[model samples]
Target: MLTSTKTGTFRFVLVAVLMLLLQACQAGEETTPAGANAGDETSTTASGTQTRSDEGGTDGRGGTLVVAMTAGNVPLPDIVPTEGSEGRRFVTYQLYDGLVRWDLSRDDATSVPRPGLAESWDISEDMMTWTFHLREGVKFHDGTDWNADAAVFGLDRILNQESEWYSASLGGAIATYTKKIDSYEKIDDYTLAIHMKEPYALLHWDLTWVRFASPDAVKTYGNDGYIQHPVGTGPFRFVSMEQGVNMILEPNTEYWGEVPKLDQLILRPMPEASSRLAALQTGEVNWAEVPPPESMEMLRQEGFQVLLNNYPHMWPIILNLQVEPWDNKLVRQAANYAIDRDGMANDLLGGAANPAVQFMYEGHDWYSEDGTTYSYDPEKAKELLAEAGYPDGFETVFVVPSSGSGNMWPLPMIEFLQQNLAEVGIDVEVEVMEWGALIQTYRPGFPPGENVGGVMVSTGSYAPMHAFDRNFASTSVPPAGNNKGLYDNQRVDELLREVQVASEEEFIPLMKELNSIVTDDAPWLFVVHDLNLRVVASNVKGVVMAQNWFIDLDTVWVE
Candidate 1:
C-alpha cells in the first residue's frame, strides 16, 4: 500500500521520466517550422527545444487539420451546447464568439477572460450595471454587422423566455452563468449595458459563456435551421455537418482577431479512445483528445507529442442529497475515505492525474489548506458507515458517462472505485450511459431510479464563484440551475451570495472558508484532478497546449 507521500514521489518521478523521454525522442529531429511570425516568442520545453509559437505568425496556412473528438456525436453548433463542455470545446467555440473569450494563446497557466466581440467593459460603482463597448468593423460569418442590437438579440435568445428564439433547454443550460442579469439595453449601436439583479462580481467571467450568433441568421433559419448553419464572428465558420460522424469548418478570413492558419478544420466524433489513438497513428487525424492512458508511453516513444498540463478539471461522483444513504454526510465522507485516490491516479490513470484534496487543485488561489483531506482508510470508512446506521453497508447505483470531454477512462476508473467501496461494505452497481444522454440527466433533480447513489461526471472549477454557485446553491436546483446533486445548505447559500458580491481582495478568503465547509460536508466523493492530456502528430505545428478544457486552433498548422 502506497502512502500519500509515496504517491506524490511516484507522480514526480513519472513526470520526470516522461520529460526525459520526450527530450530523447526529439533530440536529433529536424526542427519543425513553428507557425510564429517574426518578433514573436516561440515556446521551448525544458530541453530548449521549440514546442509552439506564440502570436508571431503563420508558417504554412493552407492545409486541412482534422481532429478526433472524444464525443460520441457531433455537437450542434449553437450558443448553448447540448453535449456540455465537450460540445463547447469542439463545435460552439469554433463557430461562435462570446462577449469575453478565454485567452487560449498561452500554455503557462489556466485561461483568463480576454476581450472578444466586446472590446472593453465598465462597471458602475455598485457593480450592478455593466456597459460593454463592442468592437468596430466586426461582422459575423453571415456578413451582418455586429452591433449592440445584435448583442441584445443574441442575449434575448437565451435570456428572455418571451423572445421568438427562446429555447427552454438552451436557456436552462446557460441560466446559472447569466442568473444575475435582470435586463439589457442598447446605449448605442456599439455600446450595451446589462442591468443585474445585484452587484454581481463575476459578470465578466459569466460573459465568456454568453456567446452571440448572427441575429439575422437565426431569424432566417429559425432555431433548428440556425444550428445547421450557425454564423458567428469567430475565427472559424461552419461549412458542413454529418451528425454522429463529422463537422467541417472553414477559416473566417474576416475574423476580428488572429485568423486561423488552417484552410479547413474537421472535427470527427470518435467516442472510443482506441479509435482516436488509431486515427492519430494512421494519419486520419492530426490531433486526438484524451488518448488511452495505457498508450501514452508507446505514443511518446513513437514520436507523437503527448502534451500534458495541469488544468481546473475534476472527475467526481456527485452524490444525490435526495437519495437514501447518500443523504447522510457521514456516508458521503466514508465513501471518500474508502477509495484510494492515489492508486486511481498513479496505477489506473498512469500518473496523468493527481489525488483531489479539494474542489480546486492544491496551490490554486481558492484551494483551502484547512479543507478536509480523505486518505485511504478502509477502517475509518467502515466506522463512519456504521455510525450512519449502515453497519452492514448499502447498495446503490453510480451512473457514469461512457466517454466525453474531460472524462478520463470512466468505466475502468469506476470499476476500480466499485471494488474499493465493496471492500468497505458498499456495493456499487455501475450504470453507463452515453455522454449526451448523461448530460441530460443533470437537470430535473435527482435521476429517477431505485437506490441511485450518485453520478460520476467531469466538472471544471475555472471560476470559484461559478463552480460553488452552480453545484451547491439551493437556488440552482432543478430547471433553475445545475445543482444536480440537490445539495442545499443555508451556509453554502449564504457564502455563495457573499462570493457573488465579494471584492477582489475579499474573494479568496471567502472562497477558502466556503471550500473548507464543503470539503468537510463531503457533498461528493472527491476523486482526482485531470492533467489535461492530448496526443498530436509530429507534423502538427503551433499547437499551444493551453491549461484549459478548451484549445485555440487559430495558430495551429499542419506540415
Candidate 2:
C-alpha cells in the first residue's frame, strides 16, 4: 500500500478491504427484534471469532502490544458518523463500545451480533421495537453512567438534523441503521427502546456500529474539542491521539470485563507494507496488517506468523450507470468480459485475493455459481462497444483511492484496467485521490459519473445486506451510503429488503436470486474477492483476527 498524502494518485491493488469493513461502519436495526437468547448465547468464547484470552486459549500475560497499522486519519471526527470513513482497529474500537459488536471471529461476521455495552436485548413481536437491557455499571472514562439517557443522547445526535454529522455529512456507514430509528424511548436507566420506521432484519447487526459516546464528554469537549480528548466505555481508554502519528491507549482498569492484558496498545500508521514488515522484524511492532506480498514467505520462514482470512470482500470496477455509454448494459458487460479477473488477482494481489463473479467471496453461504459469467474477452468487449455505437472505445476518467486495504492493489488494478479498456478503443485518464474526498463524488443526476467521479476504484464488502444496501439499493446513494455509481433498480431494492426480513432457511436462495439480478444488470465491473493478511511477531498471542478489518486488541498480549 502506498503511504498517505493529502492528495496523490499512483497505482497499487489492496483496494477497499480495510476502508469499508462492515465491522467499523457501526450502525444498528428492527421488528419486535428477536431477542438473542443471551443466557446461553452470551459466551466469553465464540468459535473462530473474537474471544477473551481465557476463551481463545492462548498463552500470554501482559506487555505492550505495538501494532503497525493504518492511522485514525481524522482525530475523533464524529464517533457518530455523518457521511465519513474512519479507521478503527487502531484506536476507535478501543475507546468506544456500541450496543453490540461485530463478531469478527466468525465466518458469517454479519450473522449475529455479539454483546458489548448492551447486556442483552429483546425484539417486540411486530418487528418495530427493540429493547436493550444495558449492562450494569458500565461507565464512560469521564465517569458518566452508560444508561438509556446516554444512548439516546448519542444516537439522537446522529439522527437530529441540527447536528453537524446529520447536515454536513453523507453517512451511509452507520447511519444506515440510525436513520431507521423513528425514535428511542427510555424504559428505565438500564433499559432502552429503539423503534424503527420499518422492520429491519439485521437490526442487531446494524447496532454493531452505533457506538455510544459519553454525553458528559460531548458537553464538556464539544464536537471538535472532543476530538482532542475522546472518552468511551471500552477496555482500552484513550490516552492520547496525534493525528498522523499513533493513538495511545491504556487499559481501562475499571472496565466491566477483565482488564486488557496489554499494558499499552500502540496503533501506528505505517502505510507501506515494507515499513510495517521492517518494524515487525525489528521488534518495533508486534503486529502489522497487509505485509508486502513478496515478503510473506520470507517472514514466515523467519518465524514471524502470517495470517490470512477471507470474507465477503470484492474489488469491482464501479461504472457510472447514470451516464451514457455505461448506461448501456452491453457496454458494462463488455467491460466485465474484457478484463481477466483471475489474472488481476493472481498477478497484482500476490494471489492473496480470489477472482470475484459476484459480491460475496468464494465458498460464502450466499455465493452463486451462475454469477461467474464474465471472463477476459477483448473481442467481446469490442463487439459490445461497437453495438453501443462506440466502434472506437470511449475516453473516461478513472478515480482510485491513493491507498486502501491492499486487497486488489488498486494502483496496479487501475493501470491494468487502463490497458484492457484501451484494447477495446477506450481511453482512461487515471486520477489518484484520497478516499475521504473521493466519497463526495457519488452524487445523484444523469451523467453523474462524468463530474465528481466516474470510477471509485477500491475493494468492497462481503456483507450481503449492507453490501446490497450500500451499492445497488436505491437508498444507498451519495450523502447517504456508498452507492456512488448510482446503480438503482427497484427489484434490487425489493430483494434487498426481502432477504433481510427472510428467515435463515429462506435467505440463501433469495439472496442468490438477487445476485443473479445484479450480475445480469452488470452495474459494476466485477473484479475479485479481496483477502486479508496480517503478520504478527512470535511473542504476540491471543490475537483474534476478524475477517472484517477491526481487531479485538484487548485479547492480544506479548509474551
Candidate 3:
C-alpha cells in the first residue's frame, strides 16, 4: 500500500540509504536494511539485531511488519475510481480514513457499518438528507485540524464540475457516486449535512468511498505533487514509494485511535503469487497476500499460518449482453448452467471458495439468498444452447487477469471453466493479460476497437449496492462506468433507483427483488464467491483478513 515515481534500482538505493540512516539513529529501535529482504531468517541492520521468532506471536509491541502483495505498485490512488484502480486502495486505505468504514470485525453473517472520521450520523425521516457529526480535534497527517471546511474541500474536488477530477477519468469512474448527491451544506465547524437529489438506499455505503485528503496538502502540492507526497489522518504516514518494489510507512504515534504497533511497515509489491509465498516462507515478511494453492500445506507444515477468510468478493463470469449468443436469454442461462460451481469450489479451488448465491453474498444486510442460484445441469445447458441456435457452440475469449486475487489461481480457474464449457460444446480461448489491461478491455470505450464484448472472469466489490451502480445501472456503460456486460433491464434500473432511496427497513427486500431480476436476465455466469486465503509467518499476530478486504496490520506484532 505504498507508491512513488522512483522504481527499480534507484528506489532500492534510496530505501537502503534511508534505512541505514534510520539504523544509525536507533537507540533501542530495530532499523535494518533487510526489513525489505524477502528470503532470509536473520536480518541485521545498522543499529540493533533483529531475528525471526520460530513460530509465535506476542503482546502488542513495536516491531516491523513487512507485507508482500500480489499487485503492481501504483503511483497514486484515485479515491473516485475505487474499483479496478490497481493498488490504489491498498495505499489509500491505510494513508487515509473515510467518514464511514465497513466493520472489518463483522463476520460473513453480518454487515455492521462502523463510524470512522465522523463519529456519528443522523438521517432524516424522508431519507433524503443525512447529517454527519464529525470527530472533534481530529488532525490530518500534516497536523492540520480536520473540520467541515476541509472535508467539504475534498468533496468539492470530486463533485464540482470544474474540478480536475470532473474533467477526467476520476469523474467517469465515480459516476455512481455523483448522480445521487444533490449538494452538501456545512451546519457547524464539526457538523455537515448531505442533501440527496433523491432517496438513496445506501448512503452509508456511498460515504465509505470518501476519504478527506488535507486541503492544505492538495493546494500546496497540487494534483501531481499530491500523488508523490500523500497526506492523510490514518495510523500509517507515507514515507517513500518505489513502484513494483517497496513502500515505506512509518507509524503516526499521534494517530487519533489506537497507535500502530509496528515501528515501520514495509509493503512490497511482488505481483507474483509464487514470489509472495516465497517471501512468507523464508521469514523475510510477517504477512502476505494470496499464496499459491499448492503451497498452503507446505507453508503450514513449515510453521507458517494459512488462513482462508470469507471476504466480500464475488467471482462472476461477466456476460457481454451485446455479444453473439449471450444476447439470447436462453443462451445466457445456458452459460450459467454449464459450469459446475460446486466442483470448482471443492476440487479446483480446494474448497477455499464458496459457491455464490447472488451478487450481494451473505453478511450484507441487503444480501439476498432468494435469487435462483443455478445448479450444474449439463443437459439443460445443452438443450438451451440448441434452442438458441448454438447447437455446435461458439468460440469466444475468456478474459482473465495475470495477477491479483480475483480468482484463487486465475489460469487454473480458467482451465476449469474451459473444461466445463467444452463439455457443453462452448470452446473458450483464455486470454490472460495484465490486471490493468483486463479492466480496460471490459470498460465501454477506452480501448477503441478491441473486441470488448465477451466473457470476463471474476469481479469483486466490497459494497454490494455500489457494485450494482457500476455494473447494472443505466449510466455505468463503458468509458464512464464499468457495466462490462452492457446489461440494462428497465425493471432492474428502476429497482436500483428505488434501492438507493429506500430506508434501512426497505433496503433488503428491494435488493432481493433486484437480485432475482438480474440473475434471471443472466448478465453474468454466476460463479463461485471466493474466500480470501492468505499465508503469514506464525510470528505475525493480530493480522485479521477482514471481509471488507482489509488486512488489519495495526495490531499485528512480531513475537
Candidate 4:
C-alpha cells in the first residue's frame, strides 16, 4: 500500500454479500427529466439475483483498497453527466461507464477514443464525421438490454436545457467545432452512430466521458437524487448514503466485465487532513491522498508505498475583474507584480510545484514560448498602483476554503503577497469557508463586487487545453463551469475560441498570444502545477496510476 501527508479537509464508500437475485430485471422505459420526480413508478428489480450475505464479503482478493482525497463529494444526479465536482468522480464508478473509456496513458493524459459501448469507429476523409460500431450482448445492471435508444436517451439528458448537466468544462466548446449534431442512429439493436457538423479533434476525446445509465432508474430517483441508489453496468452497485457522513457500495456479480475482487467499498468523509492521515496509520481507513512537502517525510517513515506521476492540474490565484480596482488593468497588473512566483514555488511548495508562466504548463509539447514571470518587486507594484490612481494601494478581503489544503496551502503565497503589497500600502483581509459554500459564493449569480478579491486553489486531473480555457475564459462562467473570477476580455475570448477549433499549428501561436495577454492583464496569478503524492500498501499489486489518479481502480488488486 502507499501513504503520504499534507493538510486539507475533504471527503467517498460500498455494501451486502451476494444473496439477493431478481428473475425479472428492469426493462426499457421513457426518458426521465433532469431533476423531476413526483412519486414516479419508474422501474424496480426483484431481490433474488444473488444472496446478500455473499455480496460484499470477499472476492478472494486479500487486501483492502483505500484512497485519501482533499475534496468532498457533492450530490450525484440521475442523468449521465460528463463533468462534475470532485465527489462525482468517486461516485460515478459505482453507477456508470462511458461509451469509450478515457486513456490516461496519453502524452497529455487525455481521453483517447476506445471501445466501451461502441466496438470500433470510422472517420471520414475530411475528418468531419465519425461512425461507431457498438458491441453486442451488452446489458445494464438492471438486465435491460443496452441499445441505441438508451445511448441517445443518456446523451439527450446531458444536452437538455432543463437537466443542469455539469458538462460545460467538457462540452462548453461544443458550440464551436460542432456546428450541428445530426442524430444518434440506431443502426440495429446493437449498433450506434454519431454525425457531426465539422471536424472536432476533441470530440473523440470527449466521447470517453459519455457514460450510460439506466433511463428507468433515473426516472425513479429523479435528478440529483439517483446517486443515493444508482444502477449501472459497472462492477459495483450503490447501497446507501448518509449525507456528510459515509457512502457504501456492493459488488455486482452479474457485471459483464471482470467483477471486482472486493465485495464492498466503504467511503468515509474525513474533512481534516490530520484525521485522514491518522485514520490510515491507525487502520481506521485504508488509503488517502498526500500533499507534497507537508506530509512527505512522515508517510515515508511509516513504510507506506508512495506513488508519483505528472498530474494535469493547476493552482491559480484569481482577481475578480468584475469589481472595482481590479476592473482597472493597471490595478490588476500591480497585483501580479507584487508576488514572487519562484520564492512561492521553492518555499511554500517545497519545490514540489512548478512556477507557471502561462495558462498551460511549460512541460506540454504544444507549449511554444515562456511568458513573462513577474519578479518580486514591491517598488514596481507600487508604481503600477500609483499609475492606476491608487498611490497608497487599496484594501480588500481574500476568501479561501476553510478546510483542507485548498485554503491552508496558499498561506505562504498569501503572506508574500501581503508583505509586497503592504510596502505599497495595500491592506488585505483573509476569510475561510468550506469548499461547497466557497464555490456557491464565488459563482456568477452571487452579486457583483461581493468577495471580489479572493483565491480558490485546487488540483485535479484534466487535459491542459481544457483546463486553461475553462479557468481563464469568461465564456466558461458557471452555470457553464469554473469561471470563478468572472473576467471578460473580448480579445482573449476571441483567441480562446479560435484555439478551441484550430488545428495543432494554429493553436500553438494563439495559445502563446493568449498567455501573454493574461500575464499582462494579471487577472490571475498562475501558481504552481502540483505533483500529486499517493500512497499504497505493499500488499496491493497491479496498481495502474494515471495522471488523473481516478483510473487506478481498474488495475488495483490485493497480493
Report the C-alpha lDDT of model 2 over 1-559, residue by residue, as the tens digit.
Answer: 5444544444332322221212321233422222222111112212332222223355466888887763315334346421132254455567788888866554333334566788777677767887888888889988878988888777766776665434234233456556567888789998998888887645766676677778888778776677677788988888776766777889999998767888888767665567778898988888887776677778879988776656555677677766667788888888877877776776666666677766565565455777656768889888988888888877766666645444334556677766777778877776676554454443332233244225654544534555677677888675566676778888888887776566645666776777778887888888877666677877778776455656667677877
* TM-score top scorer: 1
How many backbone overlaps does candidate 2 show? 35
Among all candidates shown, the one with the greatest lDDT: 1
Q: Tens digit of lDDT per residue, candidate 1, span 40-68?
A: 22232212222343323556666788989
Q: Whose lDDT is higher: candidate 2's or candidate 4's?
A: 2
Candidate 3: global Cα-lDDT? Answer: 0.65
lDDT string for model 4 (336-363, tens) is: 6776666666666555556665554565
Each candidate: what lDDT? 0.77, 0.65, 0.65, 0.54
| Candidate 4 deviant stretches above 4 angstroms | 1-62, 73-84, 105-113, 123-130, 161-187, 193-199, 250-263, 291-293, 404-424, 449-451, 457-461
Candidate 1 regions exceeding 4 Å error are 1-60
lDDT of 3 by residue, 154-202 (tens): 7777777776533255555556655678899889999998888876535
Evaluate model 2: give its TM-score.
0.85
> TM-score rank, highest first?
1, 2, 3, 4
**Model 3 residue 286 lDDT score:** 75
Task: Flag regions of model 3 displaced more than 4 Å.
Answer: 1-59, 74-89, 164-167, 360-370, 445-452, 455-457, 503-505
Error of 4 at 181 (Å): 5.8
What's model 4's overall lDDT? 0.54
For candidate 1, give the lDDT: 0.77
Work out how many backbone clashes candidate 4 has: 44
